[model samples]
Target: MADDFDVVVVGGGINGTGLARDLAGRGWRVLLAEREDLASHTSSASTKLVHGGLRYLETYEFSLVRKALQEREVLLRSAPHLIRPLRFVLPHAPHLRPAWMIRIGLFLYDHLARRELLPGSHGLRLAGGVYGAPLKPEFTRGFVYSDGWVDDARLVVLNALDAQARGAEVLTRCAVTQAQRGADDWQITLGNGRRLRSRALVNAAGPWAERFLRDHTQGANGRPLPARGLRLVKGSHIVVDQRFTHDHAYIFQNPDGRIIFAIPYQERFTLIGTTDVELPEHEEPPARAAIEAAEVDYLCEQASRYLARPVAPADVLWTYAGVRPLLDEGGSASSVTRDYLLEADAGSGEGGAPLLNVWGGKLTTYRKLAEDGATQLGELLGKAGQPWTAGTHLPGGDLGRHGVDMAAFTAELQARHAGRSPAVVARMAHAYGSATAGLLASPGREIAPGLFEAELQHLRDKEWACSAEDVLWRRSKLGLHYTPDERAAVAAWFDAR
Candidate 1:
């Protein structure tokens, strides 16, 4: 078919970006269209953990847990620069789920996957462990487990970059306004008045999946699809001055049954969050205002229950919220499934075009989700390509010879950048992995006072970072460390450049 693309993905979130990379790498012509800048949506607003959703075990989502657990290692290996292991301390509270149940859950979690680099879960004497110094005296016992943290936005960009490098077209600020199936190909119209044709379509539009399908009619075959629906749950997080002494994160259970994380963010700050509340589907740019007084009270109450110092909304330096487009599972917000559901509305024949809709998914399982999506697309398109993303590295993720040995990588980085703080080296190593060499290649030159001029230029030149928010909030958490004046200076430099 003489079409603009073989596959047209309608969202620039992680799922769409990953799928684009997967399909493009498999030698298919692919085009990824995003309404806004990439990762401006839920992709950047995640809890920043590439975990197996350990809590999902309570819901008996074994399959989802297993897939996520397996993907955790895949992500850590592929993007060691942007993803790293994080130790989480779960205090054994008598009021919460019993310790026996927790232990059993942890046991199942460890056994679900063939773990390699990350260590297994272990019981801890909170009074004797490194985390003990920061917690209250009463919390004397806890459990420590491993999960991976990610720079969610960069994950999207890296996938897009990889896809572009492999013969895919990635269009930012281009919205898919309309679509129609024409004979053997799908005709699509963009908001910018551009038209394109594709043999297949993927509605991996995250929150906009339903709307995208609703605006576009069924294909010529008229196959029925599930009435597209999603539960918009707004999750909010607050950033404050660092509160804990150790690097370990804390998973605390609130009285209301929701869980929160106290994570060490950007070295000098703590990230604590997330309250769940139902929101209208039409709410664009899910407002951080929904971070209610009650939610803040709940977070502070939970944090105070464990930490040596008290936390309150007044202590908050920044706050943000994201709407999780969960598949309509007909349950309370907390019980909703985080797994994705794919709806295909294409017929079986020589003159067939397909429309694939993605309902729900998390950051941790994005790659696997994309691979699976590509496999389904292959089936629909009758295209022959073996799955190849499991071992492939994303952009700037090549750790030559060292082979995912973080300790040795950090040691080398510390030696090379002797004048920079150890914490800075560690942060860069975690953010860029072996790619840190590219970031620090110009050793003696200062980028812009606190902001590395080279880093800023690299972001601008390569990462599709157009605004200050794209750099500070999404690309890296350097904003947390920079003063208002310094941030303004960086913004001015970006504008001037």
Candidate 2:
């Protein structure tokens, strides 16, 4: 039997959604299948930064850095609503990297990225500057630079939404059971006993990339590529009430050389993370366990080194962990490369089909990775469609009319929603961007009389949010602020919906 689609993409993470969007926009019939809800895996559990990996420069990954740096602007332009510029303050310690080396690295980082709207790197006298207000007196110097912050889970949904708008079929809770390359197309079997045929297949199963390939053979000639190994490295983060009153994020260096971030999250909380540890595959959500005593000690210890008031595990209101599906390079977890590898298996015969496998990537580089994957597919399919996503806007990203000035845009929103609290207005603006106006304009119906009723409805109606976990844990960080009763109420509302 022949296949059903021009392309079948397995995985609903950022890469898979991105590929589906890119292909479907080019007029190809595409189908994307995810075993769970969109971004129910590593995609939602990122460090939540659209960074250029300044640390990767130490490993001499110039090409990767350049690509990520360039994509930073592309993503910012594409989804100005879910992504925004964030300033970072990296404090200098006398015993750590020398001042000269840090300056040189910053210089390289600034030059690596094309400075269109973001400010360039500069020195900070931590004792007197805005960044030093929360720091310990011992920290007298720092480097301030720019990157972008993102709602990681929302990003995945936005890509999927864009793909669907362009006519792609996105099926969540639908798992691909098997795939075999055929003479004229690829035959794929779904867990629901539904069969699909496609001209091409993309194995973007993220952590399950190897497992998916093991089940799916390539080529009509009966040859299959060996499953590529992945190194599952778990990273965790903690959230606490606002530690400081600044908009800038902090990148704290630990005694062991690992770095952690204390970023401004939601307006009322600070986000801290993460610890790198190796865990066995097939582990059930490795991050749901409580922050280990050692990990908390390390975070508090490092945070205390730079802050005026010491932080404790008791201060942590919430925590999350994600496993980075790094390409196995046979090294310690910390030393593994954050770069991605793309492998295409094109069968030998004239009528053979093509299969693309994506292994290892970070959230920051997903857009570029998808563009490259589509280009590779274009080469195999002999169709050279002009790339359209680099400058295209993701849902709710139409910030061009607002001149991209969040402060001005937010001021306008506050005026429009005079009855809402400033906190709610700011949250909606940041979360929904230009679409906030539309969400607020909806019919008057209260799902729950809390921080936001219209906002919750918007998420449920448009974003496929089915539970309080999807809203609190993934859609936004409201779980940190809501009381137990409030949480239960929200849960009831989500269930009733």
Candidate 3:
């Protein structure tokens, strides 16, 4: 018989790993199973911001905005290295919304929560400002607001790392093929022959939430749960070479009454994204390989509306898409809410082991969702204790307040690793923060321009990175820097390993 655990989480995305980390920290024996690498899906393919959904205000989603705003500072503190404050410029478009309306939205965005780290939004003159140089001369005025940029995939790895550190077992590439509820416990069967018994189960399977519930969460009678209240929305992003020299990002307004963000990414790229198109009823999780031609053209057209240099398909450096598993609200995909809903068999009085289904969450609310989900399941298992995730740091997040006091941290890392390139030290500091000591303890040959052999091994051993895609794309954005030959070499190294 497989050993019993307090909870067995059946997803390795942010929500599932976050719950595992939180519950394990609370002294619960936890195990998490994922069919693939951590953050291989929707969580990694985000606009990569930790901000209150500013556009949601127009939809009158003030509560979601407030909740998201409240969690922004908390997240910035938790992963200082991966997340940092960014200023976003919203160029005025009289054809779209009026100045007064934009002001109201910015006002609500600033005051919706207790913001301590971020500066409030304010108007800006575009004539000679850093935020205006790349924009067309017609955009003479704009609004500058505070949000945060994050390495979205790294955030997931950090949570899983922290969970493992707290004694939770994280199983990547291990799918839960079936689960059977037997009285107060659940017997889970993995894709492999391994099995596990747990007192509670959490289905935090992002885009596959509904399908997972139907196929994996079985009852004593061996039947799946009824799949309901779910909608899949595909959000796509396009990356292009840097169009501007500044650090600020832009929130462009489209004539279609939708908005898109063009943010500075990885020092030499501009990341633009996100169209909300509902997936077909038959399609569950949309393809990740290519963004639709319409999506690519839409993003280029929208960004070109503001950029002095119009973008085209030929300018695209990368393109990716992910399907959001949202609550079915019978609305247009763009109009559908970003708020999350947590439901449980325990609450519905289903007489078996507790099962929590995580549905419809954005990156901003992931930590809060984890806390709430963990607290709920904890209470069901009579292990409810002090809520401890807030103000707590994720792995390598121990940089000081505002996450800006990092000069010393980088300098110190460079000093400690004498004879190492300061550039490498700086990059590692941003990637691993205070944990750079372990990663740099041994000298490593440079496998690629910025990547080292030791770094690849560390990811494989510590973070469960199994492929070139895992290390290059998700663990860090090294794929953007690696030459084709370098990428092949890295893949070969993994094969040998």
Candidate 4:
């Protein structure tokens, strides 16, 4: 017998989890299926900025920039622990972009949306200044602007957690192998052998969205539905030993009209990235996008142009890549719009089931995308619910008595766990927010430095962590700090369990 659901969402990335949470909160019976762990793809491999895409202003993408800027404030308020304010320094490059042009762009960026939590942008004299210390001596002028940073993977998991708490079933490591549209519902088969019937279906498979439609879905009359066009662009980032001690990030302009970011990461490393290289449409992206040697050379060379200390490929500590599924607009990969389009189909009209296909979205706008997408799907399915996520806090986001002040909360947590390492305490406080009390209540055996057995058990029991990679890379970035032996120990712990 096929289990029943109001909606069956495919993929466990940001959009899928966010949509599931939104729909589930509206009283819909939701079943979210992920072929792998949550945010194991494009979502987690981001440059980790929650900004308004400062460069988009150059292309006259005012509407897109405004929408993302508005959402930026909403996200900052929603999850202060996982998302925090970050300042970026854009060194003056008169050859690349004139100062007047950059000034106008920053002006628009500052006033595009109502700013509350963050300050406005301003010009900076980079010579002999703290912000200029890391840059080459020739860089004398720059601009500083406000944006936000996020733990991208945790954001996805938190959405899934909230969905589950609201009566949705979250199934990771479960793929929707087959889905048939019936007159009133979707009959779906999973790789795990479970069968389900859902009134509506959502295709949010990220980079694999088009492929899923082509391979796994069929029309109500068993005919094939043509998939929408998507252009796959591969973006890669590299992590290196900390280059600067300050809390600011840098945005360097490249001769190719593309930009690169060198951001402070994990308290000890500098994260640099993101080269846009388009992949052939006929070829499928790898399960894990690996950084190409050319991409690495490009990033290191671009960043080195501004930094006082030169960066070589050998300096890279770790690297990651993600394929962005963009709307197939013919142009250079960097010029394509970062906006998204939601296409909904009501099969056979009348009592026919409806399907919503999500295409082309950025990390900064996932929440708004979910809100808008849910509103549309809800109306189509006659299950519309007033949007409530705008004013709500995500799970572990409510820092009671601290409001959006994460530092205060972390200090208090450190005091409470005086016997523990301050680093571990601070990480836990920021990671779990108010939930840190429960995470440290027992503080079971210390499996590795700053990693406790209790935390591992909590991940396995509540967060659906099944492997060391899930715990190290996605759940937390402790992988960067762990030695090879320590990582193996973590793997051994999971193996033993």
State the C-alpha lDDT per candidate.
0.82, 0.82, 0.87, 0.93
- Could you list the CA RMSD of all candidates, in the order they appear? 2.7, 2.4, 1.7, 1.1
Which segments of candidate 4 are over 4 A away from where they belong? Answer: 348-351
Ranking by lDDT: 4, 3, 2, 1
Q: List ranges where model 2 is wrong by over 4 Å.
A: 1-3, 216-225, 280-291, 348-351, 449-454
Q: Estimate each model's TM-score.
A: 0.93, 0.93, 0.97, 0.99
**Which candidate tops lDDT?**
4
Report how far off residue 273 is in candidate 1 (Å).
1.8
Model 1, position 301: C-alpha lDDT score: 81
Lowest summed lDDT window (length 10), candidate 1: 281-290
Per-candidate total of colliding backbone pairs: 3, 2, 0, 0
**What ranking of all candidate models by TM-score puts the best one first?**
4, 3, 2, 1
Which candidate model has the greater TM-score, 1 or 4?
4
lDDT of 2 at 32: 97
Worst ten-residue run, lDDT, model 3? 399-408
Off by over 4 Å in 1: 1-3, 216-227, 281-290, 347-352, 417-426, 443-447
lDDT of 2: 0.82
Q: In candidate 2, which residue pairs get closer than 3 Å at backbone N, Cα or C atoms, i.e. clash?
A: 3-197, 4-197
Q: How well is each residue in 5-98 modelled by candidate 2, as lDDT tens digits?
A: 9889999999999999999998889999998788987888788999888877877888888889988988887877688999999999868788
lDDT string for model 3 (437-458, tens) is 7888874777778678889888
- lDDT by residue (tens digit), candidate 4, 1-497: 99999999999999999999999998899999999999999999999889899999888889999999999999999999999999999999999999999999999999999999999999999999999999999999999999999999999999999999999999999999999988888999999899999999999998899899889988876765668889899999999999999999999999999999999999999999899999986778788899999999999999999999999999999999999999887889999999999988787453368899999999999999999889988988886899989889998899999999999989988888788889898898878888888988898998999999999998999999999999999999999999999999999999998
